[model samples]
Target: MKKFKIGYRTIKTAVGACIALLIAEYFDLHYFSSAAILTILCIQPTKKKSLNAIYTRIVASLIGMLYAFLALELVGYNPIVLGIMLLVFIPTLVSFKFTDGFISSVVIIMHIYNEANFTVSLLLNELALMAIGFGTALAVNMYMGDLQKDLDQYLKNIEELYRSIFSEIVKYLRNGDTSWDGKEIIEAANLLNKAKSIAFKDVENHLTRKENQFYLYFDMREKQLEIIERVLPKITTLPVMVQQAELVADFMEELANNVHSGNTAKKFRSKLEEVKEEFATMPLPENHEKFLAMASLYQFIEEMDKYLVIKQTFRGIRR
Candidate 1:
């Protein structure tokens, strides 16, 4: 399969950092490199996003410096105290949202503080450096186009997740066993919801300028998710269908795994024909709800089928 890939975030980060360094370099910004570095580091490509990142960084930086001083005062150069500080601080950095930002600010503060060799100086230095770093990162990200791209990527993830669920359900309907990893299902659902929430906030924040396509696409997505929620429970009954549907899922899995035909379409077609035979002849739904739901299941399959066709078309175009 031809994979769609982009590193806009990394590229933006690198360029932003480069520009920041040059800016600092040209103007002799004492904290320029660190500021540029902060811009790169605080990037939300991997996390809560720009505002959260900025907030976390500032909070963490100040809090961390406070922690540093408390540690220093309490431990006071004792090997045991330093060790304890390192132990607590390391996990704290990893665990807390802005600990890394704060710790970094504190460390820089410590350097400047020791340069002046005073506690008050250290605090001032920390605050100054954090402001620079946070400000620089903030400025660069504002102009750069990573956030929209990030939202698109997030939407893509959600799309893949729902598609995967669709595929799993297909397997269940035909194979009679729905025993896939529950954790995976739950994780994908939870994460996509979070991503959706984040994307919604971002779109709202940039409503004045950002594209309306985001809104339209996500509106459809909400419908898709609603359909999925209704359909997901139908999958729970698959264990009873396993004896009849075993070959059904196997074929679907085989077709799904084959991103490229290599003339495997013949085999896939044959397998699909066989599935139609089994599914067509299988016991029909006993009630209106079951029948409507079953019809909807076909609609879900129809969507996947249509998607696979599109995937194939795109592949052909790429080739």
Candidate 2:
């Protein structure tokens, strides 16, 4: 049954359609199915999108009915008239920026064709169907709820990957442990990409545009991951400067534990800076290999600085 489970949106649409049918039947509308059809179409995942769908549907229905009425009154109902009506109506709706309603508008055209006469009673029936369909969708979506929990879960997943990646880096620096396959780095990047998409959808769900912190958080992680990749290879080539490497490993360990903490980022940056200064004071390398090692360590410092700066900047951003 788990494999056959349906989504909440599916359930909501079905329930809304049934409610719409009951309302139309109670009102004695001849084409009660029209209300149900509209209900199914109008149920959207987000309240904002649902509202927009309702608005466009109603406008398109009005355009459809108006065009149908004019065409029927002047030229009479026939296949030729219906063809001409669609040609003109589709373009007119496009010009008026009501294209979102065009598909739903076809149902209105069908109703006009079936009735074959444009009368006040028939017009009332169309309006009643619109009200019932749109109203049911509205009521169903009012409790569709927010995606804050889902966003939080994504954040947690991404942070776990971050922790794994940093710990791997720490292990390599401390003992030159080459057991890590770098799979976590790729996994983290992929997860961050997924999280960014969901976070943007969350942003769109709100009527008022707001800064999506989750999106920014993942964006920062992605930037840090890129720096990590570059740092990994450079650190591997450095001669074992046991004391310096231990300092780096300790800082990385602290960073992995507090991946989500903004305050810890500043402390890590300060410690890394001290390590950079200490590296500079060490006696000049006696050969090319030592010089290369010194250069690589400096490069690693610069990358680590950039990584910490990304998080710090993200935390300070207002939007």
- The stretch of ten residues in a row with the least summed lDDT in candidate 1 is 310-319
In candidate 2, residue 56 scores what lDDT?
89
Clashing pairs in 2: none
Q: In model 1, which residue pairs have backbone atoms overlapping below 3 Å?
A: 60-102, 61-102, 174-245, 175-242, 175-245, 176-238, 176-241, 176-242
Candidate 2 lDDT over 231-264, as tens digits, reads: 7888866765545577677778887888873536
C-alpha RMSD of each candidate structure in angstroms: 12.6, 2.6
- TM-score, cand. 1: 0.44
lDDT of 1 by residue, 1-319 (tens): 8777666577767876776667656755455567676667776543336767888777666665555567666457455654576677666767775565654555554554344333674456445556666666676566544456666676566556655765775556664455766454565556656666656656644625453444444444555455455545654553233233454456556654553312333445555556667767767877676666556545444544444343333212111
